[model samples]
Target: MRNGNRRGKPVEKARHFWPTTKRLISYLRPWKWGVLLSILMAIVSVALNIVSPKILGQATTDIYDGILKGVQQMKLGLHITKYPIDFNHVGQICLIVVALYILSGLFSFGQQVLMTWISQKVVYNLRQDFKEKMGRLPIKYYDQHSNGDLMSRMVNDMDNISGTLQ
Candidate 1:
């Protein structure tokens, strides 16, 4: 029985990757708008995250430049008339960077929620289809295959697919 089970195991390799992917993507047709919006949110979130670091770098550069200017004035024996560092400008930059990060986080959260909702819907539809198909199979088919294996495929495999989609 063990040797027979080993021989009956499903193949691991995909015979047609692109076609399979296209077929899988077909399931997302009903939620196409949600998918598109989720993708856009992901793009915007990544862009904001990428830009925040450069904005921070600007604040660092400004501080370094101000310190160098102050040191040069001291070397020349000039009286200090004002503070070298521009605190207001640095503060504004900090605020902008913080805002960008917040926006990025919000977008990321929204994308995650949208994706979870979409994946659940897809899985729900798939389960319905599976149930309907199983009902249509002949009695002889049930007699040929192990009932435990069929149940595992119907339940456990679906759960695995749901996790992958998410």
Candidate 2:
């Protein structure tokens, strides 16, 4: 049906979603390792992103405490011999937060690349299988189905499948 409409025809619903889903998943069997690795990378990236904010908060707290201490010393009218702020500690915390963010970004990028590669490979294999099946089909099948519908299934549907996989 074009645009989800079949004129006077009734709509068809999926009667076995789980079985269909399992079949789709079978296509990913060859690249299971890649899928697992991509999932791991995504988890690590999210964890790093989550932890960085807390680390940065520690630095903010340090700065605030240092400023408060300096203000107190000023009120006491004592000669401030040393700076209240421990710049070294704050600097180290900032560096750690920066490193974490960079690592998170790297992991995220790696996940995207791996997933895209896996999805494209799956789509390529599927297209090859479809071509082979089409070649074996009887000529009568072609006469019954429109060329546009066949091409739509061959190209657009495969592209949609690839997108869904990614």
Candidate 3:
């Protein structure tokens, strides 16, 4: 059957999602601080990106005002001379925009790095637990199961999980 949910679990399997979600949450609980900080950084980055257009508009407004001021002075019979470019203010705005974008990029990169670390830490814990569980299982259990199938399931499933998280 075609999948309904994005995760591809059928209605029957949907019943398992909550418990699985709870288990995953338990695994992630240890890295709550990293998760929180990453979210904060993401929010700040988005906010900066959103504000950039308005700041750019303000820059054009400032240039327009400068031009109008220069024209008025020319009409008043002063030297028909200097272009009214405020290099200092324009330079400051350019620096501010550049800094904001740079900071946003830094924060986004930091968040990705932190998230990767957290996911790896969680995967490490899960693998350790799986190893311990395997050690505790009886030889009879191993005899009942295909060793190659078990190994493939564990390794492939874990890899899929790690890929999804990262």
Q: For each candidate, what TM-score against the reference?
A: 0.85, 0.85, 0.73
The 10-residue segment with the lowest total lDDT in model 1: 1-10
Pick out the ten consecutive residues of candidate 3 with the lowest summed lDDT: 5-14
lDDT of 3 by residue, 8-68 (tens): 7664454577897799779989989888998898898888888876776777778998889
Give one digit per residue, the lDDT tens place, for model 2 in 130-159.
889999999999999997889886798788
Q: Identify the superior model by lDDT, candidate 2 or candidate 3.
A: 2
- The 0-to-1 C-alpha lDDT of every candidate, in the order given, reads 0.88, 0.90, 0.83
| Model 3 residue 145 CA deviation in Å | 3.0
**What ranking of all candidate models by TM-score puts the best one first?**
2, 1, 3
Alpha-carbon runs more than 4 Å astray in model 1: 1-11, 79-83
Tell me the spans in candidate 3 whose CA falls farther than 4 Å from its real position.
Answer: 1-15, 64-83
Cα lDDT of model 1 by residue, 1-166, tens digit: 4434567875566579799679668888999999999999999999999999999999999899998898899889987876499888999999999999999999999999998899899888888888899899999999999988998877886787677766
